[model samples]
Target: MKDKKIERPIFPKKAIITAGMPYGNKDLHFGHVGGVFVHADTFARFLRDRIGNENVIFVSGTDCYGSPISASYLKLVEEGKYEGSIEEYVREYHEKQKEVLEKYEMSMNLYAASALDRAGEIHKGVSEEIFNKLYDNGYLAKASSPQFYDPDFKVFLNGRQVVGKCPIEGCSSDKGYADECDLGHQYMPDELIDPKSILSGKTPELRKVTNWYFKLEEYNNTLAERVDYLRANSNLRKNLLNTIEESLKPPVIFVKRKQLEGITDLEEKLPKHRTIDEPKKPSITFVFESLEDRDIARGVFDEVGVRFRTGKTLVPFRLSGNVEWGIPVPDKEELKALTFWVWPESLWAPISFTKTYLETIGKNPDQWTEWWHSEDSKVYQFIGEDNVYFYGIAEMAMFMALEGIKAGDKIDWDKINLPHLIANSHLLFMNKKASSSGAVKPPMARELLEYYTPEQLRMHFLSLGLSKGSVSFMPQVFMEEKDKQGPDTVLKDGNLLTNVFNRLVRSCFYTAQKHFNGTIPVGEISDSIMEESKEAILTYERHMYNHEFHSLIYVLDSYIRNMNKYWVNNMRVADTSDDNALRKQVLIDAFHAVRTVTTLIHPIAPKSCEKVREYLNVNENLWNWEYIFEPVYKFIVDQTMHKLKFLEPRVDFFEKHQSQISF
Candidate 1:
């Protein structure tokens, strides 16, 4: 321990952190902030300090265009609820989302909108670049797929305008639209159950429309290989890995046993396949080796009038639609009228936002390659569980495809650059699944700010254990009058700062001022204290490397409370014996613990930690990992000249929200 032989965790030299973009059609709900952005911010801030701040760039934006926004805008305009052009309406929410992020101290390098002003112009260029690269690499295909057409409205419906039961087997999604469900399950448009156009409130007919698609289905084997690569190379979340592997399955169709009863010739009529007919199960599964064979079987099934549902698997990822509000798809193969689909273009929006941020800072836009493609860099994308399909699978396949990676091609670990996805489970509202479109609507992100401080909410969100499973955001303030009687669970973690840690820090400062004329004695940290501090630092580092945030608060809780208890118990003994020597040693050991705690918690509660640093009268070197294990005297270049700032009586650095303060 004297020579410091312990190995430390290595972080990437340059990193990019991205949180999922909020759609421009609505203000951010609580899940957007508590479930994703706070977690993303904590890691980004840590990377900024672990490496240099300049090496980390965190960016996300308003997903400004798509069918959802179009549907929302038209509904509002017709209801006389809004009086503005679509651009103006989207901009309104974009500004609001930015404000909410700022109030919460998100620490984003840039928050640009996909379809607004300079960022929009840059995004359009980036989208075109991606499409051209994929086209030249032979991954783009123009296919005429069945689209929902509303006869009453005399128009083809966008994906979100059609609502039906999900066609993916084993999915319990509340609602499904065109080719995907609200829970991010993707399937064929033709397989949707009882489809109805929201435009006319009537059944829609299937109309063949030509649009561009990424050959996602053909890359099933290639994606399977990528899954193998990730399993060996990454420490990703179990749910995220399982979600991706689920989609790597081959094409499958399930038929209810009751519906196929007495149809003895069903197997002979369909294409060649393998059947798993378990008598105890309600349905029979038919698995095909390829999509072409499955499509043939599908036609035969429809001819015989047998009902079926598809299992979750990779399908042709549609890249273009006729939605006018979206960024225009690069006109290729004489297809001039299509626009990029919201899901595909938004996948690359982070790249566009990166370029825009670099340009605004007067750096070359192409410098994005260093952060995006270099071996020394890593991209960490944080998203909710519902988006694992889009971020973990679709985006990853498209990224590899853009790099000329195709089926059967070898992936060189040194050459290929793919993001490390961090998808958290749903953050429920009072233990119930909540969505803006659902019966239990989620509270807006800003609404919670009314009752709690931003730091309080940030601390609580980080401790919710969302990495392991879905967690309820049941703030007692939001509960019914009869149910609001217990000690508020939301305040449990924040009190470590506002009550315990705050008192210990104040005790150290006040004690130093009264006993040593405000100058802490220059001495070595006690061996016990140094050993414990090193252990805490290493544990915190490992948890961060794994992105296990809930465990971090657990570490802080123990370390902070122990330091407080040590001060309380020892100080009483020192006061009885009038032992100044023992008192000074206790102060020295406690201050070292204070420094380590302050540095470790900086990521989760940044503003308050900075205040803690200011009172210590130390420079930014206090946060440098090089001196992370050093005692307080190392930060003070002139120990004799340094005097800690005097703490005013009853002043708290980490204060409770005004609403939490009682008279």
Candidate 2:
């Protein structure tokens, strides 16, 4: 006897999906769409089809209150670039971002902003509520710590306003801010090396400032357990888990051997730590058992002029800062006149966006709990690998703390239903990482539309294998050194749709028109074809559940091409042998394959698939996953009377842009 077949993957009854928010400072670059949004939108569209459309909430927003936006506004104003206020500046970029998202056909239920109109008001309320909850739960503390202050400008600097080299061990980030590096490692403000104030172009001083902080270090063991659980049971990305584990390591300091030689009896003066001295290495390391001991040793090293760099580890997650351009932090005791740090506030902006969307539909705002706080529901956050430290670690700890789980208490992952993070690796441009501030400028998301259709770009982006590694977006149109006439590598994956799948769809309709009076013939589908379709469906479902999108694309490619081959090989025999029954059987089997292929590709290339539906003369029910395995005739009210729409000569269901036609 054969072994029992594995059960299909289970999906949540209710789900919330989110893409990482783009800053309101500039228009979207290609990485924003290719690396994150397109993948997220594809999965969201699949969920809407797999489950009921009403059960999924997909949202994202403009991060409108960050220091980067404020800094850009100030610089523009100083350069006589614009005369509008800061709010107007942010609104202008927000509108542009929305327009770009629309151009890409991203199926977000709501693309809101943290500081615009109704969403802004709701976000303020949500921020205050989270702050009060953390405070009441003893997770928030007011600590007086040094912040970067520029004496030349007589003002306090926000994180983005200060530039320095990252002091985290083994970090290769090109840009580092006050308290965190571009790679998202947390450290103290004073740990940055060679700090310079962007406002004054001068070295800044560290002045004691009072701000509220989330006691993240207190949740070290809890976070470690969470990481272990995800590693063993969840589909979390490997690189993301490695980054989180790096942050969970015990605190340590690395000092040059020469610098430490000046201090005699250094072990007696400092706190207890294990020293690792290697004769072959230039640096000696001091590992501590606790963050408290690490800080004590740091102070002792400072007094003796022993320069050192700190390793990646969890520190106090700051909740408030002194930036005047941010949301106002609630006045609690002496921690007055402070603003919520942009990072912490941005984490919960999706909840606010969900509430705003619900209220817009005339539903109670509090009804969002059905999607976020229930056991039958799950939240999937799509982010870049650079943000794993914040989303995977910081956000998880904060959500647990909100559920009344104390710092050291073990968290039941099922009870909390914390978010499932899907982090993609970097999307490099021209084989190098591109950033707006970097030397190699990246193309904007909208720029690619001039060369290809949105569906073409979407299909290509989804096939790039970003889930496993950093893949380069090397568009032939953008290459600086290219032949005027060479095969475009970017269109290789897209041709599976534009050329092969398009040809298969047209063959089915044209054959129906030629032999069967443009009506779908009723006959039995072969067992071999049915089994192949089931295999493809099961494989695709598994890849989607695991967030293996590139592999899913491969499955689609193989299934679709084999389907085309099936039509070509069988239809030839029927045409030569002059057998009506054979032709009818071929039409029945090929039509079923076409229907299945259309439904599977609906989420990736929706517009073209809808066109395929129109020519088939089918209703919108063709997309319902419930009828996925059934024949197209099942959707016809009267199979005998059903006739497909007339196909015009030289018609193409999936078309290439006119620019691609040389003739």
Backbone clashes for every candidate come to: 0, 0
Model 1 Cα displacement at 323 (Å)? Answer: 0.7
Worst 10 residues of 1 by lDDT: 406-415
Model 1: which residue pairs collide?
Answer: none
Q: Taking the tens digit of each residue's C-alpha lDDT, what string does model 2 give over 1-663?
A: 024486788999999999999998989999999999999999999998888899999999999997788888888899999899888888998999999999988999999989989999999999999999999878988898999999988988888889999999789997889998888878899889999999889999999998999999988888888888889888788788888888998899999898966577899987878988999998999999998899999999898888899998889899998778889998999678888999999999999999999999999999988899898898999999999988988898898889888877756765768899999999999889999988989999999888888788888898999988899988888876644357777787788989999998888888899999999999889988988898888889899998888898899999999988988898899999988898999889999988998888898888898899998988878888777778888778787779999999889888787778678
Query: In terms of lDDT, which candidate is strongest?
Result: 1
Give the poorly placed runs of model 1, Cα more than 4 Å off: 1-6
For candidate 1, write residues 1-663 as lDDT tens digits: 567787767899999999999999889989999999999999999998889898899999999989889989988999999999999999999999999999998999999999998899999999999999999889989999899999998999998899999988889987999999989999878889999998889999999999998988877887777777778877887678888899889889999988887788888887889999999999999999888889899998898889898888888899999998888887787999889999999999999999999999999999998999899999999998888888877887898887777877877765688898898999999989988988999999999899888888999999999999999999988888998866898899999999999998898999899898997777878888888888888899989989999998999999999999999999888889999998999898888988999999899889999998888988888878877888777778687789888889988888898888889
Candidate 2 local Cα displacement, residue 84, angstroms: 1.7
TM-scores of the candidates are 0.98, 0.97
